[model samples]
Target: EEEKEGLDKEEEAAKSGAADGSGEDGGGGKQEVLDKAKGLNWKTGNPKELKATAAALIEFCKEHNLDIPDDAKQARMNVGRLVLSMKGSSALEIVEEAIKKYGIVAAKAAKAEQREAAAEAMCGHPGNAQLLLAFQELAQLYFKEGNRNAG
Candidate 1:
């Protein structure tokens, strides 16, 4: 009887807090963005600004405490490509072209080496080509995974 009463009280507290907007799950908004990122079409969305897209992905992962999936990484690289397209910089041009032709994962990542392993493990699926491209972009940029503060 006492345990049931305690459980009821906790449930009420949770419900009330939710009603009052105090039980912020933090994943609601981020989950929506994650869904979007997960479903982003690579072919279309021309003139895609990879930097902004990457930023959005990063924000979503931070809020939801998730890892950088391959597509998001591709978005980042695409951003760099867009920048190169606009400025015609030789340095970025090399990367932009290099990635479109052949995406290299952990090509020379001495800092984010752990991310390479994680991405490789995730590439077990045949559909992870885009993810592979993204991971390579991350390695090229030395992007680090956000803090994994998952509860």
Candidate 2:
């Protein structure tokens, strides 16, 4: 009975925190950054707002201990590109991408299984580097083709 009561109390606390956005899992830490991004007066041609938005995103990543690119200049450039290429991307989405890119979050069980399967498949390859290079080239080609099709 005591254990059940304790579990109930903890569950309630978590629920309240999530409902009010007062817990880390609820993005309480990111609310200020989100507000700042949303508060910006964005225009397609407005460099000031674009720069501010990128700054806010970078700051958010830093605060969350996500890896920024090793090349600072390239990171900024990529962030600029992301800001300009926004079709329906949200600030939260941008941060989430960074988190995934940096492997900041642990993979779910299914993802882990998939990764393990891929690794096993690749283990028998005699020329891993060459295989990877070919794969990268093919991926780039596919991306180019996709862009052409989209536009």
Candidate that scores best on TM-score: 2
lDDT per residue (tens digit) for residues 52-108 in model 1: 443543454344333233585664665445444544333223323333232222221
Candidate 2's residue-wise lDDT over 1-151, tens digit each? Answer: 4433543454454344432333455343335544444543434357777787777766665665444665778778876777677624666566544443442322222333443344434545634645643554576577668864433
Off by over 4 Å in 2: 1-45, 87-90, 96-151
Instruction: lDDT for model 2, please.
Output: 0.51
Provide TM-scores for the models: 0.19, 0.39
Q: Estimate the lDDT of model 1.
A: 0.39
Superposition error at 125 for model 2 (Å): 15
Instruction: Give all candidates' CA lDDT scores.
Output: 0.39, 0.51
- Model 1 worst lDDT window (10 residues): 102-111
For candidate 2, the clash count comes to 0
